[model samples]
Target: MDSLHHDLTVVEQIEVSPPHATIGCKSLPLTFSDIAWFAFPDPVHTLFFYDHPITQTIFIETIVPTLKQSLSITLQHFFPFVGKLAIFPTSTRIPEIRYVEGDSVAVTFAESDLDFNYITGNHPRECHKFYHLIPLLGSTTKVSDYITIPVFAVQVTLFPNHGIFIGMTNHHNLCDASTRFCFLKAWTSIAQSGGSDEPFLANGTLPIYDRLLKYPKIDESFVKNANVETFDEEYKLPRLSGPTNEVRATFILTRTKINGLKKLVSTQLPTLAYVSSFTVACAYIWSCATKVEKDELAAFIFVIDGRSRLDPPIPAAYLGNCVMPCFTLARTTILKSKEGFVTAAKLIGQNLHKMLSDKDGIVKDIGSFEE
Candidate 1:
């Protein structure tokens, strides 16, 4: 028999209520920054065990207020624009399973455990996952300028066996991996400390949004008074399948690996930095495929993140998907050459820098076309 079994006895008297509001923020004329934090579609949940059988009534009473207070403080600073984006705050809800007399305890355990399994499913393109918390999938909400993503709560439950589970899910597109972790850590600390009168949230002084908003004519006019070109056909990527599937070949290079690659390159060029490693790798990949891809005249493309090199820091993190891709061109024969990788990487990096540095016609070109 479980030692905590008797302690799990049900109490009929005490009562608790759910938190009235959750932590979130609001903003407008939204951009990728607003959507990025919202895209982590996984649920975020946590579990705890109380020393005594926590009656449903008492459990809700003690937990709800704490959740509300903590979240309220965390959101005001971390995600100042979340509420403005979403009609409502994603929340804290305690979901419980009822059991009948003499039902096997093991059966109860299985059902409650489903929550944990749900949190680990998909890692979104944005690269954030709450493996520990289940995401509320396929839900949507509307806020301000954009549609609201289906908001989810980290569900908490106390079992008759004196164990508890909390689950969470969030989409990665909405927040960067780092920002997601920061929010989680802050939320967890608050939960553990009960409720504090003063929440240590970050003070947001960045006014990139305010400045952009000031130029309303330039802002709204750019998107509206523009000439829109219509492509004759929809563009789509070629799908790769079958025996030769796309395999992720991730290599974590140590300082040694980097140094060795540089040494090899320097034997000819006299000086080469490890930053060119990706270019080298790309060359190797292209050489292997040139015969096949070139025969078909297919285009090969690589993506770059153009940020910070702008005249002013473009609020890349806060601005969400504030990114553009630059391309490097080559013939099949060029890619097959031994020096292709270095040459390509150098050109890629240089092009990236040039794109960010060139401000004369960047936005203006597009606006003029649209107008």
Candidate 2:
């Protein structure tokens, strides 16, 4: 199967219109919004499987028409922000990405004979993933508010075994992690619906970033208390006061266990926050790992999407990042407490809620800091 792996060829082609008359325009500077998207953890490309095979021909035939219709409608209604870096020639163009010669987008069809079990262990092998920057990864459509993002999928063969395997990749420019998932699910639904009533819009109206910027300003105070550096500088780098390596561990919490936690917290003195389950879980796990008492200081940093909080509507589905962080604090003593997990969760929840809606919340704090 290992040799078969290399045998799998990734067929690529771009679906786009004619190129610009000339090449190499001036370099486009990134806007505040553009930098906002870049600030997020660089999006990771994912590999997953489909229960059935839709031949690339069939998929292309089926998907293109629907996409054309949807893209037309989307551009008219929601001006998506695909960012500027990957646009063909110079970056300042209204549309961010374009297909020039020799560039191809990859698509796939499921094959039963190919190995589908390319999945290695609980997580897919990092080496198996493909990393490429879509030159127009997020270029908006030349036709206003719309943008065409290139998504790629490949089949893989692991070991000498021959069974069908599929892999998909997309440049992060067009969608944040959440938007990526939204697009995938939306694509599947649209495909299933034959493009009827595409469910691409977020439930609520998207907030307008231009106006919302007034509330949350950027500054040193907006910077994370944790060490700040370019992602390249942070790679394999230890946390400011922590070890060289950070390990990810997972656990499943059953409803029964959740009830037990609730019961335990009710019996404890301070009211534990019901909101911090995941945050508290992290604290507990970390505390156990270090074999230290619970009272030590730990921070829970997480994102809060501000779409609904904005004063005006922005294209909710615009293809870029629009997330802010909320940091929670927990003491080691709280973790060692009898209801440590629940306690941490409660405190985390409180802080998270306060960060989002408190009169003097993080947004306001950041705004003042920027001033």
Candidate 3:
């Protein structure tokens, strides 16, 4: 662990904001879907490795400036990324992301001495080895009636002469995976076009900021579940630390393998309502994980994008979270049996079918968070 600390060096730390005075004070309130995640302390971390080799001089002179300039321009369109989350101490006052003029996102430039190829491989590696690449959000600070928390940060690490790694850390309450992907698409397009947002403006979709989904009871329930009154000046997000036994690896399931699992599920349960690649993949993984466990009940929880499932249906580009949870539970003994995979598939498929086919609409049970 001590050696891991010495393997990476911080080159520079800077803050990038939109062009001077382009964005004034702006705030976006959190909906029920977003408020459901208010109590979650883990921020989302992502790393992108590009196998482009270049010298340190070229990296600093060319790559660094290009990214910084493009990100600054991109922030003009996605102002919420540079904003801070404002959390009030009482549930009566909901939380929101507020951005004032001159607010910027923290960006770090770093260089690592570790093997780029080995770290990028599919094999399992110590999770701590990659922690240095992820940047931490700014500390939470109290301002009069509310606390402000930084929602997003970026870190770009150069594995000099091997590859370039881009790491991003974002608070979940700010946005979901789809919104983040859209932001990246816009950023990369602007960067490739030499810091000009003309190309992005021509083809990209701008985020919809209107608070579209409205369910007052559901929102109140989620706020109560989050226990907003407990938040104070001392609140801080959980940080990832090193020197642990955890290892991370990626597993790929080929199209043929996925089809085989689908076929197996279809053959056993001909009347099953849903048996797509996703359900089968989840069932297979869940079965494998619980096979060694003792005979006790276990639960599997996954989220479904509610954009299309809502009554009026939300725009694909609507910002913030619009997802609902789907849960499946079964005994470990059943999962470890010979028909474990099939049983798991049945459970997941039925649960999803029931949730999506609810007569009262998909958002009806959103108040379940209070349970």
Candidate 4:
């Protein structure tokens, strides 16, 4: 189980079309960043909830209609999301994100009897409660096989007395963290402005569709790592499932604790350089998480933002994925030692420093992340 299951039923499935048809929408090529994730299982779902103390009649009558329109307008600018990914067997060209005039985003309207506060509390709650909120794209069983269904989906689950839930599921190949957030901000801005798609400049941060910033070709290592096995033609699992028997909790480290951690790092090693809050925090957590004995090896994997590191430097507003993961390897015993925290801090500092100073080496060592 990934989260605690709850009773969530769909009332309606709305096909949200782009307010304006996307020009030249037959096929859109995937960037190298996009191609890199082709072999992974269907992308995961994410959810957000809003606390609006409004009556059910008013919510169903007013907010639902506004959301649909705003979403349609948002999709006008992000038409690729309405389509599905295409992989041609004989063609040497990379996969494409294809769409037709009739393509639309699936937005489902749902209502939940589940306690809103129980799921949304800052204190620990059942992780299973999340299973029913977000819509899933599809599911797969074998390591190589996947079900590529819808590219994007949304759910509006009403909580009778508390608030509205805005849940979303996005295909990973299409957007990264930066792109996802921009799309969301666009939706909110339009909805707030009476659900209009006109004067797109008002959104300020439109996504750049330029493919020039991406690598000319897909990195071979990415695919090889994914297909160590073969693709299965069959499907097995349901779209989304919850993790079993696990308690979920959130921990907040106060400023006093953060300062104390920094002090500890300094005391552990005077030579530890560039010890920032992130370094100390990561180091402290890393030391605590690793339980292996002295001789085993442990790796700290960090994903670095690659926007400004490119040759000419890619624009911050440029869309698609532009990030790479770098790993720091050390002995588990050494990491768990009295100097473990300082060593971890130094290790993180070393990798971050390399990101700025030794860009080429890091780029060459880029390997796909597999779990």
Candidate that scores best on lDDT: 3
- Scanning candidate 3 in windows of ten residues, the lowest lDDT window is 361-370
Number of residue pairs clashing in candidate 3, backbone atoms closer than 3 angstroms, sequence gap of 3 or more or interchain: 0
Q: Name the runs in model 4 displaced over 4 angstroms.
A: 1-6, 20-26, 138-148, 198-200, 217-238, 266-273, 291-296, 361-371
- Give model 1's TM-score versus the native structure: 0.46
TM-score of 3: 0.94
How far is 327's C-alpha from truth in model 2 (Å)? Answer: 2.5
Tens-digit lDDT string for candidate 3 (70-150): 999999999999999998888777789999998999999888999998899999989999999999999989899889999
Global CA lDDT computed for model 1: 0.38
Q: Return the lDDT, model 1, position 37.
A: 28
- Candidate 3: the clashing residue pairs are none
Q: Which stretches of candidate 2 lie over 4 Å from their true place?
A: 1-8, 11-34, 37-41, 52-175, 195-250, 273-298, 310-319, 329-340, 362-371
Please identify which of the two predictions, 3 or 4, would achieve the higher lDDT against the true structure: 3
TM-scores, all models, native as reference = 0.46, 0.54, 0.94, 0.83
Candidate order by TM-score, decreasing, is: 3, 4, 2, 1
Over 1-371, each residue of candidate 1 has an lDDT whose tens digit, in order, gives: 12212222222211121233332223434332323323232333333333344554555576545655565444434443132123222121111111112211001111133222222223221112222222132333333322333222343445423445444433333333344555656666666666542443343232233322123334333323221121112311122123332332334556676566555555654433323666455544555567555533334465334335433444543433343445666676665567755555555545544554556412223334334
RMSD of 4: 5.2
